[model samples]
Target: MKILVVFVVMVLFCDCVMTKECTNTPTQLSSHTYRYALLNSKNKTLKQEVLTLSSHDHDHLTPTDDSAWASLLPRKVLKQEDEFSWMMMYRQMKNNNGGSGKVRDSGSFLNEVFLGDVRLDSDSIHGQAQQTNLEYLMLLDGDNLVWSFRKTAGLPTPGVAYGGWESPNQELRGHFVGHYLSATAMMWASTGNDTLKKKMTAVVSALGECQEKMGTGYLSAFPSEFFDRFEAVQPVWAPYYTIHKIMAGLVDQYVFAGNDQALKMVTQMADYFYKRVQNVITKYTIERHWRSLNEETGGMNDVMYRLYTITGNANHLLLAHLFDKPCFLGLLAIKADELSGFHANTHIPIVVGAQRRYEVTGDPLYKEIGTFFMETVNSSHS
Candidate 1:
């Protein structure tokens, strides 16, 4: 009896070890470092440039303020990527607005504080963020942000926004606003601020209600039937793209907001995909109609990897690979450089998944190919 008991204990120990190996928790380097690196690399913010990105008039813009916009990013990534994106935006804004150093400075300040490089002047900071309308994406100003959340909450308001973005402004308000949710939430949690955190929490709650109302554990700014249509291959708007926005937003909420509900929300959506996608053949056929319309299924992998991140489910990861669709997989598997004419944003997130695949599976080739794709896209497309 003693021998048998000892053997059982040994087996349990081995199983525990193997389970740990399979879990997708960051075992070594932080999962967040690369993102901050990208932000810094975005605009060329020097690592040593720690100047306070503030003006005398900016800090008091809002009364009784509290938020973390200062420390959400991973330490290695905080300085560089945050600045780089600002540099990129500054260049673009310069081209459009003409000689607005202050505009670029505001972007720089926001990124710096967001990643924890400096404290923002609460009073002037809001004005600065609002003044640079294109970049800051202040969620507080318009009825649109609240309405967007309410619409997704199923409040039956005609003016209710959907997709958590002002649906009327896809390019300006949709995916980009999601990035703000993520960044803002991250900033708040890392720094212990309740305002931004509360704001994001409300949005998350509204979206949760929407998911509940749909009664299928799925939520989005778009209609629920979008997935069915995608499976049916019927004509529809970019369902996968919209899914990416929500997926990324949810994942961001988990990462930035530290909300257990956010994690559950993401997992439920993944479970929904796992439950629904396999036998649905018609979606592909419906998708083919886009050859005439020029609107192809873009941003599929973004959602898949987001699912993979939350559930660490092999099915979610495999589904992302499945999204290689008829167009890219065969060629991408072979490392084709001929992928030039594709929409830049649509495909880059796919490569991001390939990179994640490499991370979890220890597949070096996925890393190589994903890096190559990123290099080509950043250099040529942007």
Candidate 2:
């Protein structure tokens, strides 16, 4: 009887993971994932009925009812600015006079200009949409990215070896590969284009194979040694960042494609990382890892949050918070913005995690820091 019961449960589990096809086109998508992310102020209000799912899962909260408290933003800081490539690309707004000018305050006003007052579905984007901009983005992002790494772009170093493409900017290759994977994942989720879906599936497959070949359970378009250096407490570049992109892409695939292999691929990567980098250290472990850690590896825990949501694996969620770099965040704890000339994308998203945490934990300070950082970076960086 027990054996029969186990078999019945197995059959049901298999049924849940079945490979479902996504047929939603761009036109059809206006109602689904597009609408999910493109929610207007009204829809956002409806989403507020919520409470915490966990530290990692989304909080169903929204700013409503006069924001639960009155607040004032520092007026002077609103005009301070910082520069980043992508945010600058979007700040082409012109006032009545056509005299050329840049609206200086990037970090302060960015939130209002982009996430708020300016809508993602604005006619401005549709009217000026050119293939070149999107194509450039497509080329500029992802692991083993062909366009930027093509001999025309540069020469092959690591992951760009696929299809004989080369990239002079070796540092750009890893993160771009990861970003392209994410973009492809987003493109797949948004459009359900069968051709692109197939292409992305193949890309994940090749990446998974490369990961397996290294025997370390981690995978990248670059040398496996990056992970080794990271785990061994040696100096390294953005391993956690690249891993986050790849895992986020996989989770996105599971969300959109319901792909089994993609799910497995991400699980393996997480397992490797969780063991090597996350709390596997001894209490009296070396000083190098203890001190330099907050500098390089922070987002491993954030990705675990998403993976936990996807696989219902509690461990993934637990591990995501393990690398909480409190010092940089201590600045957030105090609402500081001496945050110039450092890693922009890394810290920005980490602040976002704090925002999510506030909603789940009902911690007001998290709200204060997240909102402040978001406002600061939006105005200054964007």
Candidate 3:
């Protein structure tokens, strides 16, 4: 029975490649004509045919006169070899208004299944467990959850902080507050508990106050210097990872609890990171910037993509694309199973981000990355 359950989970995770169709399709009009040199003209013709058929939109097509084409096509191509042509296509899509390039039907997200629509039997074990969880969520003191945040933002700290992970000196002190917000928001939706929603809404309101005090669109238990260390490649705990949790929690509050303030706060947080990442990329090459992803970043890409779905902000979408770790994803894109030495759990969230990216943009490479990673991890690493 356990094996069967695992198999079912694997199948569902690995085969989730399709998405919803977009309503607004971009009008792709190409003006340049291709004038290929006679030498190896046949290969160029084949390449042109391949590009033309890559997508319905010609906007993703590389300019025929561009010198990059010379490097893309070798004289003799292997029949079944994948040159990762989709990478270029995705780049073009990204450049044009942050990958909102009329998503192919197969890559857009299906209609969302709201938690409010679900109901479990009251007497069932699952239902009872949910009730117990909701109760616990309410019992948690909102002041305690925001203590570190208040202190970080120089606001008056009203409640004693929790020990262990929530300790003042803990690098991951405030990560749990984000988790708490996410749980409360979800519980409110699942049970339609107005009390629970009101409590979590107050928490969101408190966090918003903390964010305003900080005045940089940044809100974290730790100092912003953590990110400075993160970008400098110095030793620091997972700052971006912690930030991802907070951002995700705010998103859940907005999505499930309908807290507009939560959305406003999270969008500000995304904007903060957008400028930060762009600065790093400007100071150094993008490849150099990717090296900073060696630390655990949790699901930064996942939350950013989720945020993009709601706000449709180009910077949010750009930030989502930036969080993708190409070194790991590039290998998975090619079906390579080199998950031996890396931390197993750290990469799972990254794969979730890839899944969300595929859902948003319908980029086949992200779909391939997600599917291949799931299959490899389940079969070999399981």
Please list the residue runs of candidate 1 whose C-alpha ends up more than 4 Å from where it truly belongs after superposition: 1-143, 146-165, 168-177, 189-192, 281-303, 306-310, 375-382
Q: What TM-scores do the predictions have?
A: 0.55, 0.54, 0.75
Candidate 1, residue 80: Cα displacement in angstroms equals 46
Ranking by TM-score: 3, 1, 2
- What's the lDDT of the predicted structure labeled candidate 1? 0.47
lDDT of 3 at 117: 97
| Model 1 Cα RMSD, 1 decimal | 25.5
lDDT of 1 by residue, 197-288 (tens): 77678767766776777777776655566556545434344556656666677777876567778778777877776566554524443233
Instruction: Give lDDT for model 2.
Output: 0.47
- Supply the TM-score for candidate 3: 0.75
List of clashing residue pairs for candidate 3: 19-106, 19-108, 20-108
Any runs in candidate 2 off by more than 4 Å, and if so which? 1-172, 231-233, 278-280, 283-290, 297-299, 340-342, 359-364, 375-382
Give the deviation of candidate 2 from the true structure as CA RMSD: 23.6
Model 2 lDDT tens row, 252-354? 6676567677788889888876676544355434333334343334355556655664665555654554544444554554456655544444456676665
